[model samples]
Target: QGLRRAAKVQAGQKVLVIGAGGGVGTFAVQLAKAFGADVTGVCSTKKTDLVRSIGADDVIDYTREDFADRPRRYDLILDIAGGRSLSHLRRALDPRGTLVIVGSERGGRWAQGVDRALRAAMLSPFVSQKLRMLVSTENEEDLQLLGKLIEGGKITPVVDRTFSLSEVPEAIEYLRGGHACGKVVITE
Candidate 1:
């Protein structure tokens, strides 16, 4: 909600999601659509259909193409995967665009999310785009909205695979392989 609020997602703005098939990215896509923005999702070739199924107006197969390199610019970017460097992501955005960096893979051992947020802040003053990190606090009202969307069939959680409690090792391996179509949930 912070990103959507800060960017002021309007009825016709263009939003880009870098990892549309993942957990947070999936929510980002739906929320953007619900907020009335035209959303474009970027995921691997294997997740293209999954991204499209969630109401993204466009899905870019990152395995085959760099959506960021395209001539099209976005008004807001919810970068769920910090795969691209700061400068590269900025290139895909409009001069006054907002970049919401929400990935934590780079900071290996400690305070992963914090490190990314700090880096974004450090690079902010020198750039034209409003680069920042997102931190969502789920409240009752928003959860109610999310619940309504799920119950109403406007949004659905994509479960890539379900694993028994004893098979957690295998589930971890599956996620590490990077081919899981959606969320790998472990149920008792």
Candidate 2:
């Protein structure tokens, strides 16, 4: 819902989601599809099937190809796996497209992904495309809306693995390894 709300996605818009096999990316793909957009998911080769199964019109294996080099441009691009430069991402966006940076996985402790997001904000006004960052906010209204969508069969949560409370450390290690296919859950 955050991505949808931030991007203001519309019907028939071509949307691209990076890290589509991960937790947030998976939800973004389903939400965009539910919103009636033509969705494309980008992930590593091993996770292509998972992304496609979740309703992506197309899937790009980042390990096999660079989505930026593709001729096609998206009306909206969601960057959740933030390793690429802002300039590289802009190349894949339509001139008037909107790019929402959902998360960043780069840099050291001081700035990390925040630096790239800041750069995007600084550069946005000078460019034709809309570049912005998303900090997800939880509220009852949005939760109710998401629940309705889930009940209506428009969206479904994807849980890749579950761990006991005692396994929290291991769970974090697993996530840091980047092998999980979807959302990780911790249960008591």
Candidate 2 structure quality by residue, lDDT tens digits, 1-188: 44667789999999999989998888899999998999999999888999999899999999889999999999999998888888899999999999999866656455764888888888999999999988788899889988999999998899999999999999999999877888999999
| lDDT value, candidate 2, whole model | 0.90
Poorest 10 consecutive residues by lDDT, candidate 2: 104-113
- The runs of at least 3 residues in candidate 1 whose Cα sits more than 4 Å from the true structure, single-residue gaps closed, are 107-116
Candidate closest to the true structure, highest lDDT: 2
Give lDDT tens digits, candidate 1, residues 101-134: 8756655445654676667778878888888877
Give me the candidate number with maximum TM-score: 2
Which residues of candidate 2, in runs, are more than 4 Å off? 108-110
For all candidates in order, the CA lDDT equals: 0.82, 0.90
